[model samples]
Target: MRLLAWWSRRMLSAALTLLLISLLIFAASRLMPGGFAEVVLGPFASAEEKAEVSAKYGLDRGILTQYWLWLSSAVHGDFGLSMITREPVTTEFGLRLPVTAELTILGMAAAIVFGVPLGVLTAIRAGRRGGGALGRLASGFGVSVPEFVLGSLVVFLFSRYALGLTVGGYVPFGTDPAANLRAMVLPAAVLSVFVIAVTARTTRDAVLTVLVEPYIAAAVARGESPGSIVRRHVLRNASIPVITVLGTVTAYLLGGAVIVEYLFNLPGIGSYVVQAVGRRDYAVVQAGVLLAAVVFVVMTTLTDAVAGVLDPRFGRSA
Candidate 1:
């Protein structure tokens, strides 16, 4: 019952947050410098033509009325027509969302696979003299490099010189699974860098704290193996913070994917958004922003639920 109540509260908060975000997205879209009518009709278009275009699209309506109409349509899975493409915004978003989602998922998976182990190993080694240096160095390097810079470097080194890997294109997995994976690798790796840094640092800190806990000492005194103690106590406790970091990192990846996708020439929602914004395609922009917000909220909520399961105190407290 308490769990249900907690989830209901979370859902309500998420809905309200999304509503606020939608309002901001709408306002920001309106604030874009170019008039949508001029973009669609060209600069040579007569004032009469521009006026007709604006009125045709309800652009002349009051902001609140426009929002109400758009929001109403959006609730029914209609995001209206893109001024640039003349195609349904929903259709475009639907086509692009999966690619971004795949990239995000792969990046998160790679980060967890690499970062968590490295963090655990580093924490264990830190107990010995002078062992934490390598972890610190790695985390520093990861944090220092920006995603776009790293992505460019990867393209330069791998695509241009050494590996001769393909650069700046995407193949649909349905069409060519092997090619798709190959194409996704670099962008996903670029996306994972900050995730790896954050997860490793957070995990290292959490594990280090757990290592000195009374339960850990008790386990060690009872002749428990290091692996067993880690599995039983250290990892369990450390996971809470690591999971939180993972959730945060995943949310960050959604935004970071924009640059990475543009650099890599991937046809994901990130690139879609970039193009839409450039063309002042307000419907596309609004839909993209709302979708991104929904994904972030859902991912974070699930992370919290998972944490609650792992540590009953969280569940009970709620």
Candidate 2:
């Protein structure tokens, strides 16, 4: 019952947060110079044509009324048509979502696989001669570099050295699995770097804290193997903070994916949003950002739910 109540509250909070985000997106879109009619019909277009376009898109209505109308239609899954392309925003979103989804999944998977182990090793070796200094240095470097710079460098190194890897151009996975993976690899690697650093550092800190606990010493004194003790006692306790950080990493990945996609010319939603913003395609921009926000909120909420499940006390307290 407690868990159920907690989940209910979380969902309600997420909905309210999304509503606020939608309002902000709508307001910003409205504030941009020129309306959809002006952009669509062009400066050479007659005033009559522009007015017709405005009325067609509800652009002629007051800002609040327009926002309310958009919001109402959005709740029913209608994001309206793109001003530039005249295609439904939802259709483009559906088509482009898979590309970004694949990139995000690959980046996240790499981060977890590499980051957790690095954190564990670094934490264990803290204060020793070798002492995880290399790991720490690598994490620092990863976090310090911007994704675009890192991506450009990767492309240069790959091309300069004749590494023979495909650095750009996307292939749909459904059409060619091998080529698709090759195209995605570089971008995904770039996307993973910051997240990997964040996860490793968070894990190291959490594990270090857990190591100092009395139960860890108790486990050690009880004739447990070193590996067994760490596996059973240390990681479980440290996981909550790590999980929480990873949840936030989802947002980072979405934001970073935009740059990464642009650099690599991938047809992902991130790139789509970038293009929409550049062209001032209000419908596309609004829908794309809203979708990203939804994904972020859902991931975070799920992360909290998982944390609560792992530690029942979390449900009670939260």
Candidate 3:
């Protein structure tokens, strides 16, 4: 019941945050510099035409009433029409979400495959081996390099040297799974870098801290093998921070992927959102923002819940 209460409280908090973010996005989209009047008018429209178009879209409605209606529509998954495409926003988003999810999940998987082991190694020999500097340098590289630069370099190498590899496009997995994964590999690798670095650094630090605890010392003195020490003592204690940093990275990964998707033309949410922004597609923008916001809240909730399960002593742990 206590755990359930904690989960409920956190969820409520996330729900409130999500609501505020949605409202902000909706209001801001309407107030964008040229205004809804211009958007409704679209490109090459005259001032009089703009006014007529705005009236047709009901831009004259009061913001509060508009907000309520949009909110209601959002509840029903009616994300309005794309200013640019004239297609339903939900349809566009539905097509894009899975692509982004695939990219994000693969990136996280790469991070885990590399980071957990590196962190464990560094933590096992903190001061004794002094390899933290190497891990730190790796983290610095990951944190400093934006995805675009890495993405371009990746594209260049793959397109130039790789045999039978296509470049600069998206093929849906449902259409051709093999071709889709092939196309996805480069961008996903780029997206994973920052996340992997973060996980490594956090894991190393967390593990080192846990290993130094007196109980860990006692366990070592009792002749616990290094593997056993890590499995039974270090990991158990460090799981909280590991979960935290991983969660933070995961939250940002999809948003960060915009650069890679744009450069690579991946048909993912990142690409969709950027195009929406460029075209001033309000429904697309609104849907993208809401989706991103909801993703953040949900991931935050997942991380907290997972961490509590992994390391129940987290909140009270010193």
Candidate 4:
């Protein structure tokens, strides 16, 4: 009953948050610098044509009314027509979502596989020479370099070396699995770097905190094996914080994906929104951002749920 109640509250909170985000997305899309009518009709369009265009799209409606209409359509999974593409925004999003989803999954998997282990190593060898430097280097690099720059550097290095790898173009996995996987590799790798750095740093801090607990010292005094102690105690206790960080990072990746997709020429939502913004395709922009927000909210909620499961202390608060 307690868990059920907790989940119910969580769902309500998520719904309310999403509602607020949708409103913001609508307002921002509507307020974008250039008038959508002018963009769609071009600069040479007559004033009468622009006015007709605006009225046709209901852009002349008050913002609140426009939001209600957009929200209504969106609730039915109808995101309206793209001003530029003339196709349904939802349809375009559907086509691109899988590409971004696969990329994010691959990147996250790599981040966890590499980051956790590196963090653990750094934590265990905290005072030792060379051990601490690796964590610092990764975190510093991630913080200092913009993802676009990193992506460009990665593309240039791989392309220059001709290491039997493809650089930019994306192939549908259904059409050619091998080629698709090859195309996805560079982008996923690029996306994973910042995640990896973040995960490693977070894990190191969490593990270090766990190591100093009285129970850990007690385990050490009792002649427990180092491996056993770390596996059973250190990791178990450290995981909650790492999980929180991973969840936040996962949400961030959804947004960060745009830059990577553009750099790699992948047809993901990130790149979709970029094109929409360029064309002032309000429908596409609004829907894409709303989708990203939904994903972000979902990830954070799931994170809280998982953390509650792992640490009963969280459940009390829930």
Using lDDT, give the best candidate's number. Answer: 4
lDDT for each residue of candidate 2 in 1-318, tens digit (9 for 90 to 100): 777788889889999999999999999977888766666667789999988877876678898897888889999999999888789999988888888888878888987899999999999999689999999998888889998899999888976786767878789999999999988888889889988998899999999999999999898889999799888999889999999988888765664388888888888888888788767788888998888788789888878888887888877887
Candidate 3, position 141, lDDT:
92
CA lDDT of each prediction against the hidden true structure: 0.86, 0.86, 0.79, 0.87
Indicate the worst ten consecutive residues by lDDT in candidate 1. Answer: 160-169
Q: Which 10 residues in a row give candidate 4 its minimum summed lDDT?
A: 134-143
For residues 165-243, what per-residue lDDT tens digits would candidate 4 score against the true structure? 7898789899999999999998998888888888888899999999999999999999999899999999989998899
Output the lDDT of residue 280, model 2: 76
Q: Is candidate 1 or candidate 3 better by TM-score?
A: 1
**Model 3 TM-score (2 dp):** 0.91
Error of 4 at 18 (Å): 1.2
Ranking by TM-score: 4, 1, 2, 3
Worst 10 residues of 3 by lDDT: 309-318
**What ranges in model 1 sit over 4 Å off?**
42-46, 254-256, 316-318
Cα RMSD for candidates in order: 1.8, 1.9, 2.3, 1.5
Please give me the total number of clashing residue pairs in predicted model 3: 0
